[model samples]
Target: MDLQQMRYVVAVAETASFTRAAERCHVVQSALSHQVARLEKELGARLFERTSRRVRLTAAGEAFLPAARQALEAAERARAEVAAASGEIRGRLTVGSIPTVTAVDLPAVLRDYRGRYPQVRISLRAGSSERLVDMVRDGTLDAAFLGVPPGFRIQGVHDRELAHGQHVAVVAPDHPLAAEHEVDLRHLAEEAFVDFADGSAARAQSDQAFAAAGLRREVAFEVSGVELMARMVRHGLGVALLPATFAAELHGLRCVPITNGPVRVERLVWSRFTPSPAASAFLALLGVGAPPTAE
Candidate 1:
């Protein structure tokens, strides 16, 4: 019924726990819950279905949440416009990235963004590309630099490509294949491979590339972290398919471009819910004058 209550509803829905939502909103749990209850009563609709282990939105809550978020975003934009007139901007700007973030020089980007808008609090999270995409889609992240597999589609989110590079093979510097400028993916098919775990963007690309080449790989070791993968390859545990940027600078490892391999592309992705002022400002730095339309 009110902005405060609507925010309470959204927080609960997002965190899925009244207590956690209260902490995030910086309010007492009882106060937050009471406001939500009052709003539900006024609307004659149950906004959330509560359980011992979780808090989920009801059908009515799901229907109202998007509108509620839009309302909040509009109000924030109005405030931001006023602040812009006064040459000041301040708020939390959460961004997500995948492990081995090769798309953007995040450190450089953050340094510049801070120099420009010191009042804005920058929150960064790193995870698998798929998980980061999910977070951006769910409004948990305002924007993200994603390293998605080649030909992967960005659905339900507005995105802009930041960088693209081909996948390359990595092995110990002394490995016989290290002397080659380019290697066919099929040549590595029978080699002991160090692979990323399934469900990851990198793993999916490797899987697809091998399938396309009509080759099967023997994954001798599985790792989900880039640092571990590089270390494994450096010690000659197994060969790996990696993004060129990721493999290029590692010590004791040699990177060879694949003759015909999956491409690794980086994209800047954001939800269509509505852009926060900080998010829009960051996009502007990336040459996007305005946020793209929702899909």
Candidate 2:
């Protein structure tokens, strides 16, 4: 019913434990429980089904969760807008990015943002491009940096392309192809490959390229992180195709330009709806304009 009670409920639902939720909210367990219980009594419905070992949301809780979150977000936005009107920006900015981001120096940009708006809280999450995009669409993240295959347009969100470039073949220093000045997809197809997990957006870039070339390649190892992919290539397990900028950072690898290679497009995406004041300021820092109103 009240913001404090709603906050407690949300915290408990997220953490799935009253004890942990209380710790996160910086309150004692009993006090937090009392607030939630009081809210449940006022609503005449139990939000959570508590047990000695585990806590799960009831059907009512599941139904109430989304609106509760929206309410909290609205209250936070009200506070942020007031602060902005006073020549100060104050809000939480949650950002997500793919590990292969290269269009911008993320750490340097975040450092500058922090310096400019020390009152704002910033958090970053590293994830796959597909997941990051979903987070942006769902309001879980305020903004995100994504890399997808060239010509792929992201729907249901506002996005702008930051950079577009081709991927290069990465090989161990002693690998046979490492000595080549340049290779095409046909030649690389003969070698085993270490690539992103099958069906991931990162893997799709190469998959579409090879399919278009009327060729098929063997993916010997499937890994999640780019670091692990680099390790596999360094040990001569297999070759990999990675963004040129990202490949330049990996040691013990030879980057051979591909005559015909997959092209990746890096983009920045934000919600179609109005963004938080902090997010708007971030877009300004990047020379981007405000997001358009949702259709």
Each model's TM-score? 0.72, 0.94
CA-lDDT, candidates in order: 0.84, 0.93
- Pairs clashing within candidate 2: none
In the range 1-295, model 1's lDDT, one tens digit per residue, is 7789878888998999999999999999999999998999899999899989888999999999999998886686688767766878766688898866687788898899999999788999988878888898888898888887878888877888888888889999899999998888778786898988876787888888889888888999999788898888888899988888877877778888888887888888888865777877787777776665565
Question: Which residue ranges in model 1 land beyond 4 Å of their true spot?
Answer: 1-82, 292-295
> Which window of ten consecutive residues has the lowest lDDT sum in model 1?
286-295
Please give the TM-score that candidate 2 achieves against the real structure.
0.94
Count backbone clashes in candidate 2. Answer: 0
Instruction: Give the clashing residue pairs of candidate 1, or none.
Output: none
How far is 255's C-alpha from truth in model 2 (Å)? 1.6
Instruction: Return the top candidate by lDDT.
Output: 2
Q: How much is the lDDT of residue 61 in candidate 2?
A: 96
The sequence of per-residue lDDT tens digits that candidate 2 reaches over residues 1-295 is 7999999989999999999999999999999999999999998999999999999899999998999989998999999999999999998999999998999999999999999999999999999989998999999998999999987768888899999989999999999998999999999999999999999889999999999999999999999999989988999999999999999889889999998899999999999898889999998998889987786
